[model samples]
Target: MPDAIWQKSSYSAANNECVEVRADAEAVELRESDAPGLVLKADPSVFADLLRTIKAGELDHHA
Candidate 1:
């Protein structure tokens, strides 16, 4: 994902320490702004499920 176009959440803090995401035909990439070298890749559908889980507060108990 070295050439991927990364984007951050618009609601991210002004300090710019936030998560960034990039997507390609095969997978979606995620990385931290403060640690770009560390990347996580996942299937698009899996990423969508993660997003839904987060929005639905399914992981709230863990927090």
Candidate 2:
């Protein structure tokens, strides 16, 4: 995590209604912008797959 650079989502606005992400060599870190103290980590590959599923609308819950 030494060289991880945290970035907020592109859709996030000045009101801060999104999470921040940091990617290191091994894993990706995620934390709410309004609550930086709470962090979540996941494998980079798994994270990428989740993002793809989201973009493809494969995990939508509502019609």
Candidate 3:
């Protein structure tokens, strides 16, 4: 098991939404809040770039 501190997504609503995140020294882990046993790990740098791209409207699907 990874030593991760789990957190729900800010975008998640009060009705038991689906996303969560875990922060570690070098990366962020994403998972389903209801399923704490599963995780998807990502590098911090790549995650940062992904966030930046989302903020910059580079993700057309979100717009």
> lDDT tens digits, residues 1-63, model 1?
568789998778999999999998789999899998999999999999999999999999998
Model 2, range 1-63, lDDT digits (tens) per residue? 857778999989889878899997699999999898899999999999989989999989865
Best by the lDDT measure: 1
Q: RMSD, model 1, all Cα superposed?
A: 1.1
The number of the candidate with the highest TM-score is 1
- The parts of candidate 1 lying over 4 Å away from their true place are none
TM-score of each: 0.88, 0.83, 0.74
| For every candidate, C-alpha RMSD to the true structure in Å | 1.1, 1.8, 2.2
- The ten-residue window of minimal lDDT in model 1 covers 1-10
Candidate 3 lDDT (Cα, 0 to 1): 0.80
**lDDT score for candidate 2 against the true structure:** 0.89
Worst 10 residues of 3 by lDDT: 1-10
- For residue 44, give model 2's deviation from the true position in Å: 0.7
Q: How far out, in Å, is residue 41 in model 1?
A: 0.4
Model 3 sits at a Cα RMSD from the real structure of 2.2
Clashing pairs in 2: none
Of the two candidates 1 and 3, the one with more favorable lDDT, higher being better, is: 1
Off by over 4 Å in 2: none
